[model samples]
Target: MGELIQEFNDYRAKMNDVILGKQNKVINRLFNLDTNCYAEGALSTKTKEMLGLVASMVLRCDDCIKYHLGKAHEQGVTTEEMYEIFAVANIVGGTIVIPHTRRAAEYWEELIAQ
Candidate 1:
């Protein structure tokens, strides 16, 4: 998890460097908008994290899965919430979520075991 956090921090820093170099003001404005939007939205950070996980899982984005799962843990999203999200993911994406659900369950089990 520590490694995951460090890796995401590094990614964000690198992405920021590139994006800022290209369009500093534009990127900064977008970031501020994103911040305000998330802050004002009805969904809490944890719920957003869960939704991110669902999207990542459906899209098979391993990096996104790792980052958002870590954030979800940091934000105190429970195992039950994850399962619920997975269930919804399964219903929406069918066979795609089946394998992802298996992997996600294993990931959750490992976390719980620790």
Candidate 2:
């Protein structure tokens, strides 16, 4: 778990450095879009994060799962709430999403424990 956190941080730092240095304009635009997508509109940021977590699980994106799980936790999402999101992901993503769901659950637990 500690290793995972370290890896995530390292990846984030590298991504930030590279994006800011070379792809500043394009990445900034994309980042703004992402930020706007998660901003409060008809739904709260917490709800958006939950949806993001579910989508990440369904898409089998481990980094997305970690990012969304941590963001959701920061937004005060509970462990039980993540389980419910996992249920929805499992239903939509079918059997293949099982492992990803488990991974998301592990990520959620780690984030909350911290």
Question: In candidate 2, what are the lDDT values of residues 1-114, reduced to their tens digit?
Answer: 466776897998898778877866878888879879999889999999989988888899988888888888789987778888889999998999998877777666667667
Candidate maximizing TM-score: 2
Give the runs in model 2 whose Cα sits over 4 Å from its true position.
none
Q: How do the residues 68-97 of candidate 1 rate in per-residue lDDT, one tens digit apiece?
A: 676777787788887888888777777876
- Clash counts for all predictions: 0, 0
lDDT, residue 79, model 1: 87
Candidate 2 lDDT (Cα, 0 to 1) = 0.83
